[model samples]
Target: MPVSGTTKNTAYTIVASSLLAVCLAYIGWTWLMSSGNPVLTDVVLKLPLGENGFIYGVKDDRGGATVPFSYRYYVYRELTSNEQIASELKTAGPFLVTRDPAIKVDIQGSTINVSTNQEVYEYHSSTLFRHTNSNHYTPVTINLCKHSSDQPTK
Candidate 1:
């Protein structure tokens, strides 16, 4: 007698194969779904977080602590005297930087170099400044709170 090669359980094999396909699909979908969210450091790096929203500065070497609004606040003014600017820098490091961090980014060593984005200030005790390297009438110390304006009355 001779034997035939056809499987008797072809239907069962097909069903099993189908189930395995579905399971594999589900596993792949879950893997894709689970791989989305990242850690806090990634979010911080991708987005521009304001001073308050961020707990620490990743840019700074010391893992800089968040300073109060008061410390970050600055005011700047110009004067004809370079000596006055020097004196303020001696007393305040950050205070000097905040008021006017540097020249207009493009106007370094140029005569037209003045603070580019001029927001009105009310004047406070603290101010920052830079010298024109040419002009004496440059701003000396501008009070950070100098531009302070009272709330609009109803």
Candidate 2:
């Protein structure tokens, strides 16, 4: 009554497969329960963000830009009007601009107002005063306008 090598190999394979399945199930269950939201899963896992190797550079064809392709770029932003862009550029040193309209933190200061179109200008507090956190990053609020989505409190 000797055990065959084929039988031993089959048993090993079965055990390995079962262990792998259990490990995968545990990981999946943990992720689903902790976040309770699949959308946040990508964020938690630090998924690959296809940001072009280089970002933030001024383009000549600027007409108030925003993210062109990827909406996954995670950063605070504000849109500047043509007039505001001109005025700010005078004082704002070497800052980069994507095709999509954007303002940098260095140039963006407190009490900013921009009007991209022929509409009334929107006043903004372009300072990182209120959203200031005593953490690794010093969150600066570039107030494109008081109407901005998350305008940092000044």
Candidate 3:
């Protein structure tokens, strides 16, 4: 037997509703997952790190103006040898984060010095939220010879 027009319409409605629900859920999930993390909207500075690496000073914005939701200075290290493409640099370590917008990073010999007016902040991410603490001194210095891990170093 052939299906009636009303039955066909009902079947179409059910499929459309299910698809719409799935799409909505996906959008909501994506937004909630990325809402707390800061987005790298702009790069403020780029400096040489040794001969094959680079130090980048970036502004991370969460689209707000207060702590935990504000724009901050974030420093990262990108090594050219780690990637297949020379021009496409991938940031390996998120070295530092601070409230001070102005940050200066310099490499002297085998040491990298990071200078900031405000205290350096560290992020501790739990299952649900992001926790931050000021646990570093200004003018932070790290010896390249001793630092090997990708973990953030003070």
For all predicted structures, in order, the TM-scores are 0.23, 0.28, 0.43
> Residue-wise lDDT of candidate 2 within 30-119, one digit each (tens)?
888663211211110111112211112232322225623211112222223434333333333222222233433222323223222212
lDDT values for all models: 0.30, 0.32, 0.49
- Tens-digit lDDT string for candidate 1 (1-154): 5444445377678889999999999999999876332111211111111211111111111123553111122222332233443333233333212222122321122111123232422223332243334333232232222222355778
Winner of 1 and 3 under lDDT: 3
Q: Residue 80's C-alpha lDDT in candidate 3?
A: 34
Backbone clashes for every candidate come to 27, 10, 0
Lowest lDDT sum, 10 consecutive residues, model 2, at 40-49
For candidate 3, give the lDDT.
0.49
Ranking by TM-score: 3, 2, 1
The lDDT-based order of candidates, best leading, equals 3, 2, 1
